[model samples]
Target: MNKREDISGFYERIHYLAPERIGADKPHINVFERASCIGAVPFSRRDYYKVTLILGTGRLDYANQSIYIDRPALVFSNPLIPYNWNPDSSDQHGWFCIFNQAFIQQREGLLNHLPMFQIDADKVFFPDADSVDEIAAFFKAMMRENTESYVHKDDILRNYLHLIIHHALKMQPARDYDRDLNAAARITNLFLALLNRQFPVDSRQHELQLRSAKDFAKQLSLHTNHLNRMVKEFTGKTTTEHIAARILLEAHDLLLHTDWPISEIGYRLGFQYPGYFNSFYKKHAGTTPNEVRKQAV
Candidate 1:
C-alpha cells in the first residue's frame, strides 16, 4: 500500500468529531484507556485538532518527536499541524478533552489570561500529583455530566473546562526575560505556525500553495530578513532549516511505511522529480530512502 493507505488503519476522532468537522462551535471531552497498541495506530492531523492531555503509562510520539509521560502531563497542537503517537507499551490509562479553537479563544483576554496551557507548543508543563488529580477529577465529572439530559449542560461544561485549563496553567515554568526576547519569540512562533499549516499538501506535484520564508513573512506583515534573523536567534536555526525539517519528516514517513513509488512520493512532497527528492533526502538524512527502510526493519 501507499503512504496514505499505511495510515488508514489508525483511529482518528476530532473534538468528539473528526478534524474536518471541528469548528468554533463544537466541544467535546473524551476519556481513553490505552491498549497496548495505541501508538502503533497511525492517523493524520485531519483526525484531531489537539491533544489536551495524554494520560497513559506508555510513551508517545508527537510532531515526529518522542515524549515519555511518566505522570499526567499536558500536550496540545495548533489546528494547522499534523502529529502522531507511538505508544511504548500497550497498557496505559488516562483521559483527554478536545475542544474547538472557539472554546479557547473565547474572547480577547482569555488566552493571555491562561498562559500555562498555551506556553509554547514545544514546552511541556507538569503539575504536582495533587494538581493532576484535581484536573483529572474535573474531567471525569464533566465527562459524566455531559451525558446527562440536563439543561445548559454544554455551557456549564465549557466553564468547568476553562477553569481546568486556567488551573493547569498555574504550573507553567516562570520565565524571566526582557520584553524584546519575548516579543521576538512570540513573533517567530506565529510564523512557524503559519508555515506548518501549508505543508504535506494533498497534491505535492503542483507548485506549492505556499513556499519561501519571505512569503510567510509577508503574510504575517514582517520583513523577510528580519523574520529570518528572529527565528534563527530564537530557535537556533534558520527559517529554511525548520521548513526543510518538516518536509524531510513527511518524506521519511512516506519512505518507511508507505509503498508509494519513489516518483509519487516525491510528487506528494512538492518535489518535481524523483532525483531531486532523493538528493534532498540524502543531504539532510545522510542516506538513501532504501537505507531508512532497512533501518526500520
Candidate 2:
C-alpha cells in the first residue's frame, strides 16, 4: 500500500521553496489559486478534505470511476477515498482549498449532513459558464481576503468556504439512496464513522483502540456476524477487510513520514511482536517496513 499523504506533507512537497510558516497554524483552512503549484505532483490518498474548482479540461480518477472533464467542474474529496488528476492540457487553471474537520467544527452538521461531502455521494459537478464565473469570483475574493491583515480573517474565510459548499449543493443532483432512513445503512454509516475517527495517526502515543472487527462490533453494539453482514451488503467488503486496509494505510504513512522504529510502529498498530508486524506487512504489501522507508528516501 502506498503511504497516505497528510496536509503538512502535501504543503512541503508542493511548496518546496516557500517558508514553513506559509502553511502553518491554520489547521482548519488553506486555500490556493495557482494551478502550477498544485499540479506539480499527482496526489494519491490524502488525510484531509478538499474542494477544487477547475477551469480547464482534465481527467479525474476517484475511487472506482474515471471522469473526463471537458467543462468547468466542482470536485470534492474526503479522507476515505483516493483520487488524482491528469490534466489534458498544461493550461490548468483553478482554485482549491484543503481543510480539516476541525476548521469547521463550529458549523454544526454542515459537512456531515451535506451530500457533497458524503463518502458515497457523487463528488463531481459540471456547471454552466455563468456559474463557473460566479464561483471564480468567490475564489478571487478569498485570495484577496487572505492577503489582508484583518483580525477576523479566519471567520471571513470560513464563511467563504461555506458559500462554496452551498453553491455546489445547488448544482448537485439529489442522491439515490438515503442512509439515514435505513437501519442497515445507518449502521454501516456509523461503522464507517467509527473507523474514520481513528485516522491520520499523528503521534506514536496515539494508539488505535479498535484493531479488529470484534472490537468495532463491540463499540457499535452489534454482533460480529451482524457487523460483517452489514458491511458486506453495503460496501461489498467484509468488516475485517476494511479494518485491515485502513491499518495498512496508516502503517504506510507512519513508515514513510516518521522516524519511529519498526517495533514502536508495530506496537502502536496493535501488534504484540515485531515479527508479527513484519509478516503482516510482507503478506499484504509485498515488502518489509525498512524497504518501504528506504524506497521513500
Candidate 3:
C-alpha cells in the first residue's frame, strides 16, 4: 500500500506554509504553479483532492494503468486514488489546486457524485487548445484570489474549482470498468470507493465505520438487498462477504506484522468483544489469531 500524505507534509516538501485552518472546521484551499515544483509526485494516497492542468508532457501511473500524455490535459485526483506523476520535460509549467473535502461542501454533494472524483473514473482529460486556455483562466483566477485577503475569496475560489470540474466533464472520457455494465459499474465503483475510504485501521481509537453491508447500504442511500445484489452481480460476492474478506485480510496482516494485543486488534476491527473476534477469526481462518501470530514469529 502507498503511504498516506496529508496537506501539511505536502506543503512542507515545497518549503511553503500551509493554511492555518487545515484539518479544522473551516475550509482550506491552495493553488500553486508547477514552475515552483521541485520533484515528482510519488505513488501515495493523499488525504486531499488535487486537480492539475498538465501543459507539459508526462506519464501518469495509477490503478494498474500507465498513460503517457503528450498534449495539454486536465487530471483530477481524489484522496482515494494513489498515483505517480512523472514529467518527461524538465521545464514543467502548469497550475494545480489542492483542497480538503470540507472546502467543497454545500454544493449539493457535487464532488461525490462526479465521475472524475470516483476511484475508478477516467481522470485524464484531453481538452482542446481553446478549452485548455479556458481552463487556464480558471486556474489564473484561483492563483490571483488565493493570495488576496478578500472576505469572500474562498467562496469565489470554490466556484472556480467547480467551474474547472464542470469544464472537464464536458469532455469526459469513456470508462471500461465492470464490463461496461454502466449502472452496476457506477454504483459498484462508488461502493468500492466508500469501502476503501474506511480502511487500513490506522488507529485503535477509530474502529471500522462501515462494519456491515447494511451500514454501507445506508451510507450509500441504497436498500440493503439492492446493494448486496448489485455488489454480487458485479464482483461475484455479496457485499457482506466482501467486507468480511477485507477485514479478515487486514486481520491477517495485523496479526503477523504488529505486536498490538489481540483485544486491541479486535476492537480496531469492530469486534465489540475479544471472544467475538476470536470466534470470527477461528471460523474464517480455521485457526486462532494467536496461532497465526505464533507461526509468523
Candidate 4:
C-alpha cells in the first residue's frame, strides 16, 4: 500500500482538533502529557473528533507547514482533517483533553460561536497566563464533577466547555490573517474538503468518481485553469495531482486490506476496463495492484 494512502498520512500530514466528546452519564475530561524522553507517538488519523490543549513546548509538522507552540496553546482537530505532531526533545509539557463533536453540538446556540470549527487554525487562541489559569480551573472543575454522580452532567459540561473556549478567544490576541477568504481561495478550500470526504477508497480494482478534477471545478462554479491555480497556490500541488495521488493511495489500501478481485475493484472505482485501471495504477504506484497485494501477504 502506498504510505500516503494510509489514514495516518492523509489526516495528520495536517489535522483538525474538534469539540470535546460528551458522554451519556457525565461528560468526562481526559488529560495526559507527552514527555520529551517518552517521545511523541505518530498519532494516526481517527474517524472521530478530538480537541487538544498543548501547554508544553513541541514542534508540529503537518504537510509543509510547521508551527512551534511553546506557550499554553489550545489546538482543535476535527475528524475531517489529518495531522501529526513531532515533539521537541527539550521543554515538553502539556495536557490533551478530548471529547466528541456531537457532545458540543447538543447546545444549538453555542455551536456557531466555536472559533475552532469555523475554518483553518487562524481562529485558534493562545491564552495569557491568567487566562490559562482560568481555563484550567474550568477544566479542573469539570473533571471533579465527572468523578461524581450527577444529573444533567453532559449538559453542564458542554456549557462549561463552551464558556472555556469562548473565554479563551476573548483573552487571546486577534489573528492578523484575512478571515475574509477570497472567492477563489474559498472555492479551493471547499474543493479540497470535498476531495477529502470521498476518501479511503474501497478497492484497488476501482476508479472512484472516475476521479474527475474538471467535475470538481465545475461544481465550484470556476474555470478549470482558475481552480487549478487556486489549489496550486494554497497547497503547492495541482488539482489533478491531488486527486490522482488520493486515488492511488486508496488503491494501495484496498489491495492490502480487502479480498475483492482486482477486476471488480477497478470497476467499482469507476474504471470501464480493468486493463486501463491496471496500467494507471502501475504507472503511478511503480507496481501493479497484484504485486502490491502479494507483497502485503
Displacement of the residue 22 alpha carbon in candidate 1, Å: 6.6
lDDT of 2 at 277: 92
Q: Report the candidate with higher lDDT, 3 versus 4.
A: 3
Which digits, one per residue and each the tens of the lDDT, describe model 1 over residues 1-297?
A: 223321112233221233335333554333333332344535444423344555665455543456677767766544334445656655555555545555555443243323332323453556678877887777777778766778677567767667676665566555442333386777876776676665545454434544578877888898989999988987678888887887777677656655667678777776778899889889998888777766446
lDDT of 4: 0.59
Superposed by TM-score, candidate 4 places the C-alpha of residue 122 at a distance from the truth, in angstroms, of: 2.9
Query: lDDT per residue, candidate 2, 179-265, as tens digits?
Result: 666777778878978987887576667788998989999999899999989888866878877777777877876776578888898
Off by over 4 Å in 2: 16-26, 38-40, 174-189, 198-217, 222-297
Superposed on all Cα atoms, the candidates' RMSDs to the truth, in angstroms, are 5.7, 6.4, 7.3, 9.1
State residue 145's C-alpha deviation in candidate 3, in Å. 1.5
Residue 285, candidate 1: Cα error in Å is 3.3
lDDT at residue 217 of model 3 (Cα atoms):
90
Instruction: Give per-residue lDDT, candidate 3, residue 17.
Output: 69
Top candidate (lDDT): 3
lDDT of 3 by residue, 1-297 (tens): 334788887887788865574673556788999887745878666788899998888899763458998999899988765678898878678899988877766454556666678544578999999899989999999999988989989789888988998888777545343253466766776787688777666555668888888899999999999888888877677887778776786677667556789889999998999999999999888889988889547
* TM-scores for every candidate against the unseen true structure: 0.65, 0.63, 0.67, 0.51
Candidate 1 ranges beyond 4 A from true positions: 1-41, 52-56, 62-65, 68-73, 77-92, 101-127, 148-172, 176-190, 203-207, 218-222, 233-236, 273-275, 294-297
Query: Model 3 — TM-score against the truth?
Result: 0.67
Ranking by lDDT: 3, 2, 4, 1
Question: In model 4, what lDDT does residue 216 have?
Answer: 90
